[model samples]
Target: MARAPSSIVVFIRQNPRTRQKPNNQIRSLTFENKEGDCGNEETKPNPHREPSQNAQNEFTEIAKEVSKITRTKPRWEQTLLSDFPSFNFSDHRFLNEVMKHQNNVLLSLRFFHWLCSHRGFSPDSLSLNALFDALVEAKACIAAKDFLDYTGLKPEAASLECYIRCLCEDGLVEEALGVFDRLRGVGVCPSIATWNSALSAFLKVGRTDLVWKLYVEMMESGVFTKVDVETFGYLIQAFCDDDQVLKGYELLRQVLEDGLDPGNAAFNRLISGFCKERKYTKVSELLHTMIAKNRAPDIFTYQEVINGLCKKRKSLEGFRVFNDLKDRGYAPDRVMYTTMIHGLCKMGLLGNARKLWFEMIQKGYIPNEYTYNALIYGFCKIGNLEEARKLYKEMCDRGYGETTVSYNTMIAGLCSKGRTDEAHKLFAEMPCKGGVRDVITYNTLIRGFCKEGKIVESTNLLNELLVQGLQPSTSSFTPIIKKLCQVGDIEEAKKLWNDMQSRGLTPMVYTQEHIITGLYEQGYVEEGMEWLLEMLKHKLKPREDTFKRLVHRLLQRDQSDDSLLVLDFMLKIGYTLEKGIYASLWLLNFAKRIPDLPKHD
Candidate 1:
């Protein structure tokens, strides 16, 4: 016990916070060690001895190794809410992204909500302008309204601008005006975009008067910092489209007055407008202007000019334009050639059209479907059915498949020339020859049958259509009914009308009137009057001729009282009775040799 191990004391001093008291615990450990170390006791290692300082160093080294193995800087981190304080909506790049990708309405709304919530922006914050823009790009008007209502957001000028644009794009001009009124009530003056949108809408729906008023209003607002090309361009287009080429010229003057040169698109629109109005002199003046301005004409400009000249029956002038286009190193495409062909054909120069067709082929420019159709139609129009058929066969042989137009031309040609057998044969062979018969085809064939006094055959064809699962339209029934009435097949015509009604197809006014006329012509005056009254009951007024014919037919049968009754009914229903009606009724009453006149009720 004299010299206790110094290591134990060192360990106790190092772990001095241990619960063992240093004095008693050290003394008891020393006494036990001395007793165990008696001469007869074997020397034993001290199991309770504290670890050496080297062991603590090794533990520290392992922890450093562990940290080195597992730790590194992260690549990315979550962005905090306070990052971007101001976001622009009209930024072009951002707009492109919104348009190109964020097209869904719900996703846009959710993104807007996240933006509003995270940015802590007020409901009226300008930062939310992009969200409104996104709604427009997505065409989500209902969502936009919901967003405004849910956020208690008052309409800002930008919001109004977006709403007006969306509404105008959807052709809801009246609704757009209501939004403009709302903007004015809110004291939010519209921006250029908003004014332009309203102007465009007015012009689109042919409200030129309103467009001019808006233009004056916009000029007076003193808000336009600059007049853009698009502003004048749209105005010029509106003027030209509305058939006011002179006014369009005035607008061009205004553009020049404002120190702006009209661009090609603007000039083209003016030229096109003049061309459409057949004002070739003005078109020429504009073309010279374009040349003086060094604005090279594109294909569309040339087409317009050529087509304009052609429409005026100036094929030689059109050919001059065509040659001019060719000499300018611009290859004459199908449209240019088609214009020439159409012009030539219209001028009764089908031979030239055929010549141009051959030239087109020689130049390795294959005639398009429209070109072939035009030639065939031109031939048919001049009663050259044989040539039309020959052309049709050539078109087929050249691997140019026939369209509904091709068949229609051939069938209509044959029908016009009273070649019903051949027309019917071609019509029947249409589907088998890889051609699908559309409504026009059926209408053409039906009309052909009716024209040939084959009412029963035409009716059978109509039935065949129904059996083949094809639905005939109002147009389909109209001509057939008219022809049937023309042939005095009133009973069958009425049956067809009933069939139409049963199939949920309402006969057009013309169709019904035709049947009524047919009834009158067939000496069914009472039935005609009854049907006319039925038409009036259903709010379908008969035309002037239909009423007069029915009344005259009734009177012809000495039914003056019935005629007067129908006439009174016509007048009571706000229809003006023609003077001929009363004269006819008076003459018929005078001519009648009735022994006893029927007393009025």
Candidate 2:
């Protein structure tokens, strides 16, 4: 008979295996033919053929088992092409996995391209949806739209929802509405999820009218899915934001009527909004209602009430609330204590605020930046700069960075104490990280320089302010002019007045009066008269006392004609020139040998 075809065939090269152990060894034996003349069938049973075929079958079985084990393992562990087999182009889960690990959308796109090119798969709805979600989450709406257009994928409700959410989050509510319309055009009915999402978007941006309309539409459509908690919470928030607290309460009542229990977050938001509006009585009632409903105030609720009371200057009431919170076993955390302390300090109750501060420390609450700042400001307000400085140093030693308020307080305190040099030193040493110095800092330093009789230095500071792109307030210029007048620097005072006018800082009536008085005091009678005329041109009446002093001084200096002119001007201006006019006329007669001074205008 012809030799049988080889039973074993090698499709692929076999992997090498280690030698077998003694327990795994195979035994071989030879058998003699019991019946003679059995021809080829009796031949030794073709040991090589049987062994080889059996070994080949065993290898095939083992290979299949290994493949099954690998296939059952997690997708992440498998080799890319070997186990991936085919790309699930429509699976958003894969895209989400791509996005979750790889933040780059472009990289994700390239990955999809590679999958299509190498795996011979085209992009499907699920893949497009995944890309859309990834882009929405990443806030790349425009890119997502471009990709969808490129892939020619129709907009599904899920994809539209994602796009609409992204648009709303980006404050493009109009665009979101357009997308919703497009979704409707596609014949996809809006689910409750869709309406709720749109309604929430409207609520977030204070579009209450639109929210109500949407709610009505949703109800009339008879597609009643459960209204999400977020929908109710945002609606309440919108009402509160619009100062419609009563309306919000009414809505909450409606929620209950609808058999939906308002969640804690909704209650908290409503109460916080009421407190913000200073509707304290309403807030109290809401608190009671929450309690009656077995919903205790959360930390945020307690903090909100405390903050509101403090803001309204009802510190005593705030303290009571604090005590009530503590009695109810809700420990006042650091923020609560800080809020109370700050409020008390603002009310000038420094002693009480300090006591609370100590109590907070004793209660194991570490003082934070706000606590220290409040204490510093309180001490400063009470004129206890020494204590404020001590606390400031303590803050520095503890490595807390000096905030702008902290630096400003110290600078202002030093200036108030007439310690300009120390103030300047501290200001110069201020760390640059707190951003550029504000206008208040510049104003304070300039005013301090003026107070110290350092007019040039003050002017230089003003110049520095200009160089630094800062505009000086009217008050910033007032002190310098006042300082010049106080020191009898008439010429410099006049220059400053001109400078102020040039800079469009219209001199107030009081400021012009100061300049006139300064000129007169410095014996610049002619200049003083000019300023008085300017004041009159601006429709400002000079004080009677100032006019009397000017006239008397002019007459004493033998300037009788000038004195008479001022008296005539005073009469023209409707000033009551009784004693002042008589005194001036008397002085004029004595100076110029005239019997009476001309007073008729």
Candidate 3:
């Protein structure tokens, strides 16, 4: 047979004298399985059996044996024992090969311990990693833990690092930390990768405090000859990404103060963080620090600065930075232009904003949705309604499907100019124009109808929505309800009122109270009292004035029976009656004149 590569093992380390010779000569061990897939024969050879069949047989037998032994407790000892069943490896490579297809990690761990304790066996790093990797990939955390604490298994530091990384990838940070401390406790010297892995796991869970502590411990432990620059970069990210920029800055500055070079990414992270927090002053300072330390600032560094300027409403400053970037020969990307456009729009500098808009198109940049909205909104804000309309049509003609925002903006602009009829036209045609209208769209159009006192049109639109199987929001109905009540159309108002319940839309105070007030004002006092009872049913308290008005109206009608009921309901809801109402209640209840004491009678 040809020699295998130096990487693969032909024989494992064991006592040479204990090596067993095969009883039969090695035969061709390949076979076709049920799926016609080829695999190696299990080392157990029955001449009648195919090799592939034997590999499966070996796995099943080992699984059965492991299941049998671990079902009962292990008889563990400081040293190997002939009697301890869990320590039985089945005395073959069966356990090792069995790990390849096994996801039952605890069973694998038991076999792993047995392999480690088996005398004359020195398991290589490959075997150690294979089993542990299987455990983690199977998400057998408890099993991985068992393997970690297996007193008989002593994997080297290199093999242990791999296990730690798998734990981190699973977001099993806490478990990874336990394994890290345990490996080091066993006199295994961890490298920088090991320490960083632990830090990364803590960071994954937003545990910045633990990350800081772990970093300190890594430095003090001095196990590694050098820490990687990426270590500090990750720590900075954890802090800054959590919006703890100051903490990140403190960590970076502390390392720099200690003369530790955590590399350029450290400076870059702080610059980005400072920019994110809109701390323009600190950003500038950090940029200068980067230059002083001979760190090269990339395009990203400049972009963040410009973005910060834009975010802080310093458009002129952002343009200045943009100019600096151009001078440094870094061609500005779309984001930079968008930021500049956004900043200008915010400052009401529409003329400049439009100029940049054309400039961006000329430079072969297609403006995105936000870019269009900003320009349209700018025109609307400056009272250039016609210009806003022209641009909105241009947006649609360019195959730009109208966003809810774009449509709402147009409606809002038209409504602001009292051109609500045109606003309704645009809204009614949104679906045909490939624009989807959400609740905001309906709310905006309904608001326009209510503003123009066109309640009929608003009600029609609401009915159309219901026909289309869409539910109306509070804004959808509240304005129309208020306007109908304003016109004293109580019957129609009552129709809408009942419709609210049938649609499973609960009428709020604005709806319920407005209807009650209109009914009461129109001498629908007895019916208005019914509305209050309904309000109480929904656990919605009537306004105090509404309550008091109803009580007074009921007493005026000589319906003291209803008035007393109202008073009791009010008191139950923690409302104090007006002193006069209380006096009336006293006269109605106990302060009436008796025949013997009624001299005035």
Candidate 4:
């Protein structure tokens, strides 16, 4: 079922995914006296411009004998020189023949090396591509990386990039980077397409860690000319995908410096990335930057910024952006209005949350369950259980509270208000009585009991939940353990912690830290230290108070050595000690008459 290989003619043409920006906007970027160019321009070859049917027919026959000779002959040079004595080995067609057995990349490389070094000829891009494609198909990427050095860049700088493109297309990004590095090592500069290819490859492999360096190399090399916005979009999108929105901003600055106003699409991608990263301030910067380029913020941009701000609980700043969008004549859409309402509710700005809710309704936008649930949750959060009840009843009246999430939100609100009887009635009704029943409902009820200092009740219900074959997440156990610590029932908390581990569940870092703090406060310092080390094994650092408490206890016992050791452990775990902790350490160190402890950076 193997399809015939597409003629090499297909590759030299620009790929279909490449979009063209307006030519007038593209600016030429020049390499300013940088090294590695060897004073020669890398000539881009149109290797596939010709169909060359005659060339293919000749290569087909040449490949058969080359493959047979390569398998049987000790010295390919002697046999190749003897059997193909009349053949012009320097010609592109003959190189294509040698490259057909690209399965033996190292051997093909040897033939390629002998031909270039002895015969003083380089293979065309098509033949080199064949070699790379074979290596890529075999997934011998580590071998491909080393093969680049053996080929060197002396014969054809164009082929190096061609190989890089092939490697990138196949997701061999590391190999692509290796080839790109070799391209520079031997005094040859990479093309803009090669730079873009490596950037794309780095993005593919999720190595955004090194993407900026390659981009900087591309800019400084000056090998690139007439760079367009679409090309810049590729890089902006990559930075955005990796949640490195600042890098996207820097790319925008570079694109502007390159004299092209990156269009709204690029800005949108960065805005979305900023939103996802909860960099609310950067979202505002991106919007203003877009406006500076004469591009207005679109609906998606506003939606992302508002939602992002809401996530960070910066509803006031989100409101400013919402108002800004309105001022610019962009009528707030349903999503935009809902986002602001959700953000306000989350921030406990119930007054403004209600105002926006009514405003959106007056503007003919219908409130969805999200709008209602957010209002209800906000009311519940601010201790306005009456308003929360009213919103929940209104959501059902308006035919929007049929979903399990709506019921769960109402149940959670009631539980938070200590209306356990009402929450219980709602929870029971969720199955056959009315709505959907799920883990959140049980967890919420359990958490409510724990918060109300009803640990025995919470434990009984948890055991019942296991009896009903319901699996509990870490969240289900966290609240109980945290509440147990709050009540100083450390034995019960330890049993629950063990139960969670026995069931193969990983507890949250904050949960363990709380237990450790509780244990430490009760003078069980060794036990607390043991749990702290376990938390560290899971890559979780003890919170500031935990460290300070431990260090202070050591100092209280006049164990200055132990206190300093604890401080060093804190620093080793990458904690910047608090100012109070530093002052304590300074006093302790002075009293101990030791050389001054290392100063805080």
Candidate 5:
């Protein structure tokens, strides 16, 4: 007997050892299958008999020849017909021989095409299935689609459904929809499972619009005359993705009224949506309902609830839920532990956060970057830079590379504690230490420099910020503007103000107030009055002290007309003049006979 080729032996060995049949026996079975047109000893082989030696030799010769042809060139079609003119195209043995090179589906498909064109061959159901199996196995979705259309072969409905599912599973959703539409146009309704698979593919890719469209088409086309539980589940997901969670909730109610279990996925999605919307009450109600219905919420379900409570500044409630899950014997994963730790840190419950941190480590969950940054931010918020620094060092030692957030929090903490020099040192080290400085980094350093009255350093940083191509926000400009005004450099302050405007950054009341006060203090009373009027024109009320200071500065300069303008502006905004300012204004009015200020009603 001729030995099988090395490729064939290798292919046989790759099969599971649990198969009781030996390699020879498996290869024998392939020849026993039906051969449609090629002349054979019998159409049906005897079930009790083994393949004869001659049949084995012929199949081996075919495998060897096909392997040689596949290796030589792309134009194997002519060589294949010349080599195996009497080969059985419909035989499973031939398919198994050709599919040994299944890794190259193009070769297998071309061989199949050559068989059809030159040998006048037509594949049976089993042969077609083998082709589809190879195509799907290789994830050659586009090629499979073209082959199906080119041949105009109408595979059985089940085969088509399976192909649709394979198409969707491989993320070729648009191609899958084309197959689905073809099936529908031919008056074939795919199974509900296939429909759900298609629906899920759309949902996974966030094409909620297509999900709804297909669902409506599914209903209108009478594919599913009655919607099932899975259909309703997909509909709920679509509504949630569309941000219409309320409508999804109503549909869930309808599903419940009809006594169909909408399943755990439906419940989980609704919980996630409610969490994002901060609807903790609805989340709790659904959690209890899931438990009551014996559709017990999973880890993700509880995580959503805990995350929601934490976001609404309700960490206390979140902790309670976390404990409840623990009491139920569910071990929280690192992500869940991190969420609780973050919530605790945000609420300044450092004692609890520290306990959870140790507990997480003890429980064999390593802290990630988010976990360390959360605790670090909390420590920074409370002015406990030492603890934050220790945690940061540990985080670095543990190989959780220092993040921009960690650096920013530490820098801000140092600056807050009047350690501007240390903060600047760290800021300067960031780029060298593999840290990318963002706009927030420059803003923090600029504010720190302004706090120390280092006008030169602050301005240098502001210039560096622009050179770095970072857009400065209102925080970046406000402090520097105030500092410049305090130093009587009102011209630079005005320049920064205009620059801020040019950047389309709106000045908040703090920035406006500083500019207004700076103008008056630097003896630009008219410009100050004009700025104040600009604010008033926009219905922005300056601080009462700022308004009074402007009036005082104007009066001291003997600018009675400007003071009258100030009084008129203040009265228009419904401010009650101070007793001192009222008296001063009254004396001014008597001296100059300026128009009387309007009396408050």
Candidate 6:
């Protein structure tokens, strides 16, 4: 049965699933006479409430007459004027009733315009909301927007919120944001829900930059008196994702001070950020705060702390935290064990590393390649090459695959012990053993060969590295350059030095020292001074010992002018010359019968 006309207002407030069923009743009105009076079935007016109730009845009757004429008459506004000549079309109550009852948005819009043309006709908030709700329900958003522009009315907060939310839902977030600004310009403050809708929309589209700017505007407006946890969560995650963790933390602090908890996910993000920045104090404080607030720190939380400590070279503190988690009955995962082992090995604490290694294995955690590599690295660090090799063999036997890192670690260990031949053999066997040789692989062997004074072999590897399209780093060239300088091949060293720059590599200070010393030793004193000035131009300082040797060589050659130039340039560029070198320059100047001593001022 169709409910009374009063139920139509309740229908608009219902969920879409139920609202679709009653809409027919809102449109069902039978006109029995030319006057368009609605057919009465059962609803009776109250005698005691006659004054206000009669007005409501009259408004309902006129609304039904207008809807009927709009549907059947081609010229609806002319028909409305002729039929209801005595009706107050400018009355707000009559406008609201007609907006609520009208089914066809186009016709309703025409009637609205006709009424608007009447003098003194103004749209109140209720009538505006009714029209917006109808237009939005009919998906006549363009028309609704046109209606808004036509009236030029400042919509109330409730109507603006609904409009903004609909725009956001339609994936028109930028348009919605523009609408929000226009509404606010007219002195309308949308509620917190409205702000959150726009915020959530931008966040969904991954526009955190826009979200942050809008949030700043939201704060500056001071309109939303209360910000819920969901809104805070959005801002927190957005800030953290943008690498603005400190700003995220400030928002979190505000959330906590508001006597609300942002839950574990937010806390974890802040903890992870602090870990990346190595802010252990803040991590500790957050962990403690989480526990105090009845939000327990999960395994990932402790894992981050351990990883951070290990990276900062505080493995002992990391171990303490690891042990505390175990004592508290929290099971450390394989990642945590590997992180601890890697740290302990780096610190050369082999004993503790071995203990943890055995414990992790006994706990039924199969050690992966990283786990084996960490122990291998520890063994290598301690010069236990046999044990390191044994671990590598065991890793291969267990089907962990021959990884390049394992091969590199073992090769580096062999090379460290002057086993260059063995290291080269391992390097050669890498391709057959499914190990891809990276730049480190070539650099390692190059460094090893240079250390053994096998310059020819190192040069061959450098050429092969270039042919394979592997970009060599400064480490790749520095050792080769130094080796050439040691063997009185200053010209060859200069060629390689220029080659490094052509390949877009900047030579380190050590590379400069090698070239300078090589030139001086080869009796190219002038060229050595030029390289020294080049170093100073690039703001590079050679080792103090190298500078001393260069100066003494200048004095031995009796090049007093070049030596004085070197000292003056050094002082000008703020390099403090050693006392012995300065005194030698003074003696050289005095013996040359020069008019003035080398100026110390």
Top model number, lDDT: 6
- Per-residue lDDT tens digits for candidate 5, residues 418-511, read 7899999989888888888988988898898899999899899989999988878999888899999898888899899999999999999878
lDDT agreement of model 5 with the native = 0.77
Q: Which ten residues in a row have the lowest lDDT in candidate 2?
A: 4-13
lDDT of 4 by residue, 1-601 (tens): 1111232213212231222221110112111222232122122112323323444444456766775676457566655767766555565545555554333444554566557654436665556555544544444454444444444423356656666787787787776776777777887887666677777677767787667667666777675464567668877887787767788789888888867888877888887787777766777787787877778777887777777777877789889989878887888988888888888887878889889889999999999898888787888888888878887888889887467888888888888889877888887787764676677878999988887888887888788788878888887888889888887888888889999989999888788887887787777777887887777777787777778888877777677777777788788977777777678767877887876689898
C-alpha lDDT of candidate 6 relative to the true structure: 0.78
Model 1: lowest-lDDT 10 consecutive positions? 24-33
Model 2 bad stretches (over 4 Å): 1-105, 111-130, 133-142, 145-153, 166-178, 184-229, 256-259, 415-421, 432-601
Candidate 6 TM-score over all chains jointly: 0.58
RMSD each, Å: 21.4, 16.5, 15.3, 15.9, 9.4, 14.0
Query: Per-residue error at 413 for model 6, in Å?
Result: 1.6
Residue-level error in angstroms, candidate 4, position 261: 6.3
Q: What's the best-to-worst order under lDDT? A: 6, 5, 4, 3, 2, 1
In angstroms, the error of model 5 at 479 is: 9.5
- Residue 296 in candidate 4 has what lDDT? 79
Best by TM-score: 5
Off by over 4 Å in 5: 1-97, 100-103, 106-133, 142-160, 224-228, 324-330, 403-601
Write down the lDDT of every candidate, Cα atoms only. 0.68, 0.69, 0.70, 0.70, 0.77, 0.78
lDDT, model 4, position 92: 59
lDDT for model 1, please.
Answer: 0.68
Candidates 4 and 6 compared: the better one by TM-score is: 6
Q: Tell me how far candidate 6 lies from the true structure as C-alpha RMSD in angstroms.
A: 14.0
Clashing pairs in 1: none
Estimate the TM-score of every prediction.
0.54, 0.56, 0.49, 0.54, 0.63, 0.58
Worst 10 residues of 5 by lDDT: 16-25
